[model samples]
Target: MPLKHRFRTDAALGLVQVSPPLIYALVMLAAPLGTIVLFSFWTQDFLTIDRSFTLNNYREAVTDPLYSELLFRSLRIAGAVTAATVLLAFPIAYFVSFQVRPARKSLWLFLITIPFWTSYLIRVFLWRVILAYDGPVNGTLISLGIIDEPLSWILYNANAVVITLAHAFAPFAILPIFVSLEKIDRSLLEAARDLGESRTATFFRVTLPLAMPGVLAAILIVFIPTIGDYVTPRLVGGSGGTMIANMIQTQFMRLNNAPMGATLAVIAMLSVTLISLVLVLATRRWTRSR
Candidate 1:
């Protein structure tokens, strides 16, 4: 074949290979998102949906105090969950990456992923039972004389949502941090120590900075999904724990307002995207400076 013809043939083959995923993405992701965006511009009145393009849904979503409150609450809860999960996950990832024997690392990772064996709904329910007023946590605290009675604050509140979400997302945080830790060159730590840096100093200057990409990854992983979680809030989070997602569900299912629901969904997605971009850029700048 002529060189130009061969190049064209290869380009056509590449397009053919890419076409399936492109079509799949359009069908599975883009189409639904476009529909939601379209719906968000329309209006819904009880059982009727107005197809006219209007900013009424966005106006309500933005101007409504209830939506704002729920959105802020969701952000708070997601932030709390991300912080708790990442803080707790780092030590475990460090231990697994640095302390464990190479042969045992896989076993430890397997153990870490044991939570995946159970259904997510089951795990959420388990947390519900574990945190319930009369459940094992309260019972154990009572037996230990830590409290006079079952603690009502632990469950059916924002605390319960945080605890459950943190636990649920722990593995997600741990895995990324572990991968980052594993990629770290041990010689760098040795060199830091040789330069008279203490264990804490070495970690702060060398380890933590290098591991930040994974930490950022874990933060995004936990924060983005937790903000939109409705099941945990519905089951364990009482009125106080309800987030924007629960409100979205209520709008769609109970209130018969799909446009409002779509609006909330889009707003939540935009908020998450904005926050994620900020986090990524901030981390990148910090890492570059380091």
Candidate 2:
């Protein structure tokens, strides 16, 4: 074949290979997203969906005190969940990566994923039971003389949501950090020690920096989904623990305001995108500076 013809043939073959997924993405993801965007600009009146474009939905989503409160509450809960999950996950990942025998590392990872064997709803319900007023946690605390009675604050509140979400997303945080830690070269730590750096200093200067990619990945994974979670919040979070997702759900299902629901969905998506971008840039700058 002529050189140009051969190049064209290879390009055509590549396009053919990529076409299926491209079409699938457009049909599945893009189509629904486009519909949501279109719906967000319209207005809904109980049973009627006005197709006319309007900013009233966006205006209400932004200006309404209820919406603002729920949005902020969701952000706070997601932040708490992300912080708790990542902090708890790092040490476990570090131990598994460094302390566990190579032959047993797979076993540790397998154990970490055992939670996935059960339905997510089941786990959330189990947490609900464990955190109930008469549940094991309060029972143990009372028996140990830690409290006088069952704690009402732990269940059907933000605390319960945080605890459940952190536990649920623990594996998501651990795996990425483990992958990052595994990629780190042991020689760098040895060199740092040879130069008289203390254990803590070496970890801060060398280990943490290298593992940052995985940490950042874990952060995005846990933070994004937790913010949009309605089920756990609804099950464990009373009115006090209700997040934006619950509001979105109520708008669509109970209130029959599809436009308002879409509006809230768009706002939540944009906020998540902005926060994720900021995190990525900040991590990149910090890594480069180090």
Pairs with steric clashes in candidate 1: none
lDDT of 2 by residue, 1-290 (tens): 77667657878779878999999999999999999999999988889889998999999889999999999999999999999999999999999999999999999999999999999999999999999999999999999999998999999999999999999999999999999999999999999999999999999999999999999999999999999999999999998899999998999999999999999999999999999999999999999888
lDDT of 1 by residue, 1-290 (tens): 78667757878779879999999999999999999999899888898889999998888888989999999999999999999999999999999999999999999999999999999999999999899878999999999999999999989999999999999999999999999999999999999999999999999999999999999999999999999899999999999999999999998999999999999999999999999999999999998888
- Model 1: lDDT of residue 225: 95
TM-score of 1: 0.95
Q: What is the clash tally of candidate 2?
A: 0
lDDT of each: 0.95, 0.96
Q: TM-score each candidate.
A: 0.95, 0.97
